[model samples]
Target: MTPFRLGVLVNPLAGLGGSVALKGSDDVAEQALALGAEPKAQQRMLQALSLCRPHFNNIEFKTASGSMGADLLEQLGVTAQVLHQLEPEAVTTADDTTAAAAALLDSGVDLLLFAGGDGTARDICSLLEARGRSDRQVVLGVPAGVKIHSGVYGITPKASGEVVALMAQGELVSSMMAEVRDIDEVAFRQGQVRAKHYGEMRIPEALKFVQAVKMGGQEIKELVLDDICAEFIERMDSDCQYIMGSGSTVAAVMAELGFDNTLLGVDLIDCDGVIASDLTASQLLEQIDHRPTKLVVTLIGGQGHLFGRGNQQLSPQLLRHLGADNIIILATKSKLEALEGRPMISDTGDPELDVALAGWYPIITGYHDEVLYPLQ
Candidate 1:
C-alpha cells in the first residue's frame, strides 16, 4: 500500500494572544509573550498527531524544520522528511508559513495538516492560489489561533487527527472547498469586528469534525438569551466556583450577574463576583484546583462544538477534574435546531475524555425550560 503522505506545518505563535486578551496574535506576538502568553500551537498539534500515532505505519509524514513542524514529530518519535528548514533562533513569520506550504504542496502530499489560526490559513491559501492549486490540494487546520473564522479548520485538534487517521486507514473521505476568513486584530482589540473573506481552500469533508465558517454577529433572539440568563443566574450556587466558558450565550450569564465577561476567553467567577479574568490553561488549573467548580459553556454558533474551539483553557485535565456532571450547557432552542439533529461535539483533545463526556444532558434553553440533548 502506498503510504499516505501528510504534510505538517505549525505556526508557533498562534493563539498566544487569546488567553491574554490581545484579541488576536498577528503583529503583537512579542507583546502577548511579554504579557505571559505561552505558545500553544505546538501543544495543539501534539494533540492531533498523538491520535495519528497508531496509524504511523500507514502514513508518511513530511514537515518543515524546527518549531514549525519537526519538533513536535520528534517529540512523538515520528521521523518525518523535512522539506523546508528555518533559522532555529529566528521568530517564525508569515513568509515562513507560505514557504513551508509551497514546499509541502510541491511534494505532492495527500493532505496538508497545518496548525494555526485564520492568518495562518490565509498564508497557505495565498500560496495555493498563486500556484492555481487551490482546488487540487487538500488541506486541513488544527484550531490553535485566537480568531478562527475560517471554515478550513477542524472543530478541534483531535478532530483533525481523527480525519487524518481515517484517511490513513484507507477509509473514503470526501473533500470540499472551505472559505478562509479573518478579522482585523486592530479593530478587534478596539471592540469592533471587521471580518473579511481571504480565499478558500480544499479540505476533507468530515462534517462531524470539520467546523463550518464561524457564524458572526450576536444572537438575534434577545428574549431567548434573557430567559437563559435568568435561569442560569437563578441557579447559581454561592459556594461553587463557576468557570465561565466563552461565547455570547455564556457572556449573557455574566452580564445578568452584573459582572464583566471575557467574550472569547475563559473567566473564573463566584457568586460574589469575578474571581479572575482571561485565564490561561495553567492559571485556570491553579485557581480551580480542588474547588467545587462548574463549567458554564455553550456551543459555537454554526459549529455545534461544546469544547476545544475557542475555550482551550478548559484543558482536558480541568474537564476531567470538574467531571461531566459539573458542566452546565446553555443554548437557545433555535441554536440547537440549527444543527438539524447532529449531536454537539466534545473534542476536548483527550479522546477518552471526549467519549466519557458523551451522553444525553439537559441543556438550559430558557427560564425554567430545559431540553434533553446529546453531546457526542
Candidate 2:
C-alpha cells in the first residue's frame, strides 16, 4: 500500500504577539520579541504532529528545510523529505512559504498541512491560485496565529491531527471550498479589525475538526442587543465579577449599563461599573481570584466558536474556573440561524475542557427568548 503523502509547513514567527497582547504578529515581530513574546507556531505544530504520530508508519511527510518544517518533524522522530533550503541565518518569509508550497504541489502530495495564521493561509492559497491549482489540493491549518479569521484552520492543533488521521485511514473525509480570510494587522493592533476574503481553498470537511470562517460581529441587530442587555442587567449580581469577552454584542451590554467597553478586548465589570479595561489573561485571573465570576461572551458570527478565536484572554484555565453554569452566551437570532444548524464550538486548546463544553447549552438570544444549542 502506498503511504499517504503529506506536506508540512510552519511559519515560525506566527502567534508571537498573542500572549503579549499585540493582537497580531504581522510586521511587529521585533516589538513582540521586545515584549518577551516567544515562538508558538512550532509548539502548536508539534502538538498536532504528536497527535498524528499514531499514523506515522502510513504516511510520507514532505516539508521545507530547518525550522520552517523539517526540524520539528525530525524532533518528533518522524522523517520528512525537505524540498526547499533556507539561506544560513536567514529568516523565513512569505517567499519561502510559496516556494515550499510550490514544491509540495509538484510532489503530488495528498494534502498540504500548514502551521501559521491567516497570512500563511493567504500565501499558500495565493500561490496555488496563481498556478490555478488551488481547487485541486486539500489543505488544513494548525491554528498558530494571533488573528485566525480564515476558515482553512482547524479549531485546534489536535483537531487538525484528527482530520489527518481520518484521511490517512482512507475514511470518509469529505472536502469543501472554504475562504482564506485576512485582516489589516496595522488596524488590528490599533483596536480595529478589517477582515476580508483573499480567496478560497479546498479544505477537508470535518465540521467538528475544522473551524468556519470568522463572521463580522457588526452584523448583529442593535435592537436585539437592547433586549439582551435588559435581560443581562436584571440578572447581574452585585458581588460577582463579570469577565466580558470581546465582540459588539457584549459591548452592547456594557453600553446599556453605561460602562465604557473596549470593542475588541476583554474587560471586567462588577455591580459598580468597569473594573479593568482590555485586560490580559493574568490580569483577569488576578481580579477573579477567590471570587464568584461569570464569563459573558458572544459567539463569532458564522464560525460559531465560543472560544479560541480572537479572545485568548479567556484562556482554558479561565474558562475552567468560570464553569459552564456561569457562562452567559448572547447572540442575535440571525447569528444563530446563520450557522444553518451547526453546533456552537470551543477550541479552548484544552481537549478535556473542550469535551466538557461540548454538550448542549442555552443561548440568550433575546430579552425573554433562550434557545438550547449544541456546543461541540
Highest-lDDT candidate? 1
Q: Please provide, for model 1 over 1-376, each residue's C-alpha lDDT reduced to its tens digit, 9 standing for 90 to 100.
A: 4467789999999999999999989999889999999999999999999998889997789999999999999999998999999996888899999999889877767789999999999999999888777865778999999989999999999999998887676443455678999998898889999999999997875433221222444544777788889989898988899999999999988998999999999999999999999999999889877578999999987788999999999999999888766899998766776876667888989999987776545578777656555677
| Model 1: residues with Cα > 4 Å off, grouped in runs | 207-376
Task: Give each model's whole-structure lDDT.
Answer: 0.85, 0.81
User: Would you list the clashing residue pairs of candidate 1?
Assistant: none
Clash count, candidate 1: 0
Best by TM-score: 1
Separately for all candidates shown, the number of backbone clashes (residues 3 or more apart, or on different chains) is: 0, 0
